[model samples]
Target: MASNEVVVDGEVVHCIGCGAAVQTIDKNMIGYTPESALKKGLENGEVYCQRCFRLRHYNEIAPVSLSDDDFLKLLTKIASTDSLIVYVVDIFDVNGSMIPGLHRFVGDNPVLLVGNKLDVLPASLKKNKVKDWLRQRANAAGIRPIDVELISAKTNFDIDRLLDQIEKYRKGKDVYVVGVTNVGKSTLINSIVRQSTGIKELITTSRFPGTTLDRIDIPLDDGKLLVDTPGIIQPEQMAHHLVGKELKLVTPQKTIKPKVYQLNPEQTLFFGGVARFDYNSGDKKHGFTVYAENNLYIHRTKLVNADAFYASHVGNLLTPPSEENKTNFPPLEMHEFKTTRKSDVVIEGLGWVTVPADVVVSGWAPKGVSVLIRPAMI
Candidate 1:
């Protein structure tokens, strides 16, 4: 046994991954290390705990079963301390990425809004225009950030600029990075860590929610720290209803190749069972451009036969929330929107459909998912 090893009867050790107390029982719980693994780790003076082991070797993520009360308690700690809040958001799913009541928890700290996943947008889109649009949306949500930076953590885009901004705004205080689940907070932190400390894959990351269970701090050059906080699970995000593989189908891994579908009134488009769109009323054929995962299966049908098509094809043709997840899947709810001008009908966490001016369209998603309309982002 090592001199630093402190072994208690019940709680034995802390995981090197996310710094959670490790135990040998409860396979479903956080920081579960097998008894044999713990013994081996103690003998060799190398301990990774089970969660960190799986994340490093298999690239798998385990959900941190944290209650809302527990998560809010963690956020409340930030309010008492002086820190710079780095609020990261998914550029593709802006509405779904917002943390509710965040202003109350951040006190008067200046927040730097980081819009991630910028690589998922179309290449032709202007960067300045997108930044302006994000600023307006964040302001509307009652979040007034000191600066809004657009970056793609997956592609390493504009990371240097973000780091420079952090150095300038942090003013020797600790930086706390926070966001709702699946917003690339871990990915962004990992990138920053790799650049600053030459440490690769320090944190576990995946498309699923709750990969980070507790706060992990990385020391900065000036003795300040960059803290990564656990992501809050928003019930409205489609990621909550989806299985792991189903989530990958909805989350875009690369730049979306916009698929244009020309439709007349009474036509429908099904994005698997995740989302459905109907052109209920329109004067003529309008172009509907879909910005979603490149490999997601899309089917077209008559509006009248849409129900029957979904019923028969859900598990087979329209998969992802496949047959195994059918019981958990909620019945799709309908939301009708009349577009006075060009806009995007966004199915939060899935993707969006750009519709032309003067059209009546209806969007459907599983219950609890958010369906909203916003000015066209492209």
Candidate 2:
């Protein structure tokens, strides 16, 4: 439901949407509302911070603020509740987006994996292959989802199918949608509202039965609640390291165009200073297909000279530190992997580089962001 009136500090008002304190300043912070909107909501006996108002009316998303401890508390509350967990993740950044130890938090609730932004991948990438890979990754993360559905919220593709999967697995139980930010939860919510059958607005914000934690609920026709939880912010995502303009270069704003390169044993490919791929050892020339945002720069150079090259050219020749951020940019930490089989060296939020078998490579990213290898998807 839209507004759950909760009094805070005896005078301060809290948002019914995600139970955050509402403020009139700093749009980037959680629970921000313009004075006019707040007044109108009060006159109507309802109040929604701009984020919730936009989420409900326009299918738009805004940033939310939460520390790790609070997020863990929320997850703990979720574990004690009886609900079906709809775990959404970015198809592009599954490993980086997963909440560590999620399997332990949901208690007995079965999970449904929703992979959003399939359209961002190339048309040649097989959807079935991607689904299989996603399932494997989810398993590795200790979650055995009841099913996996890959869809593009931007295109409204497979939305009805997603709703059907939710209905099938929910078993007349309440549904809890959860994900880290930028995984397209808001868009998915919009699509579900447009497609799901027998939807009714939830009117009560009473703490979820046994806990003081509150969630925004939309009632399903069957009288079950479909709840929207606050998106947790993962500090390891690349977005936390770069400035706003630099973030655009890494984020897939449109369909990514594949770039393939032939590499030798000591060659390196720099994904703009955002990531580094060093081909430390490989016999003969092998093809490496890059799946990244079209605008991100990929530069190739001899591995021997890579340090000097990056040292001299990080901000300009290699970018995303831009000229202004180079000195303050977090140092990239390297993780090495040797593949016995064809694989994708995924640099989390930044896309992946598909490499041939029997090759040793090292991936580097902003200190906290992860770099790992997964069995090839395509």
Candidate 3:
């Protein structure tokens, strides 16, 4: 059968289950269903991709890889289309979560920046402050979002407000929701579905051309679509280096409790074997507060002893290279920064340490992972 031809009805159409195009070949590709499944779905008067077939029948998400070509196709479609872009980012790892070069691809579409995992931050942090930070970060990445929203998808906080904002800004056009993996984009959509019609299951009954990417199309009452683009995987995250329990251990689940440490120059703190912070120079003693998952272990030692300590203790005393994964873990690379004002030394995918103005610090992370300074978040 031809790639575009529907074996079922002799007409070209997408999966009624998830809107992906149906293909009888290449199970690795999007919109692929077994010949048997296709016959069954067509006999039932609807065609479903195996991805959605499994989702509907077994409640299993059989993930399909959205290839680079597929992603570029999605981006090109978005650029040519008139829609509201709902770009989601993780507040904890904002810098790592942005889709590279998205601003250029967005064309005339107005972007609404939605920062997820806001509940992971301290309650003392203001929402406006978070939005400002998110805007600054987005702007730095060449995205000037028309508006910014901070919400905790995990807690369902501000989801309704976010939906309202989307409804208002979309203005009867389609809405394209985009994000990197782990930003909780799917969870946010689930919440929206639950609130909109109390339908717990998201059945994509609409039809569009098989775009090659497994884009979920949610029909709007306005005869438009709310497109959920597949999440892109970023390799720069420290998350790429971890597995099993360590990833979960480093990921914050709720409100972060700040841990304050009285510090002087020439002191070093180890954030497991994953990251390190050194108080290299300072005018006086300052208290640095750590904002990371409560479960991650932090070890402090004199800077002079730090080298020898890490050399011996890493992967043992310092973990999450955890011992088994140590050899494969990249060597720690140093990134030094001097704070002109209160700033955060952030280790991407780990967390951050907030320090007072005028402190010279050095952050270390596994090579290729990001460690940088930003204005303090809280």
Please name the candidate that would achieve the greatest TM-score relative to the true structure.
1
**lDDT: the better of candidates 1 and 2:** 1
Off by more than 4 A, model 3 = 1-66, 201-213
List model 3 lDDT by residue over 129-191, tens digit each. 888888988998899898999888778899999999999999999998887766777667867
**TM-scores of the models, in the given order?**
0.93, 0.83, 0.83
Clashing pairs in 1: none
Per-candidate count of clashing residue pairs (backbone under 3 Å):
0, 1, 0
Runs in model 2 lying further than 4 Å from the true structure: 1-34, 42-65, 196-214
lDDT, candidates in the order shown: 0.85, 0.78, 0.79
Q: Write the per-residue lDDT of candidate 2 for residues 287-355, one digit (tens) a residue.
A: 999999899989999999999999999999999889998888889899999999999999998999999
Candidate ranking under lDDT, highest first, comes to 1, 3, 2
Per-residue alpha-carbon lDDT of candidate 1 for residues 1-378, written as tens digits (9 for 90 to 100): 333334766444666566556667678777778889988877775566687788778877766666877778887789888999999998878888888889878988999999999998889789998889889988989999999999999888999999999999999999999999889998999899888879787777877777777787778888888998888888888888888688889888889899999998999999988889999999998889998999899999999999999988887789777999977888899999999989999988888899998999999988888898988877
What order do you get sorting by TM-score, best first?
1, 3, 2
CA RMSD, predictions in order: 3.2, 5.9, 4.8
User: How far in Å is the alpha carbon of 337 misplaced in model 1?
Assistant: 1.3
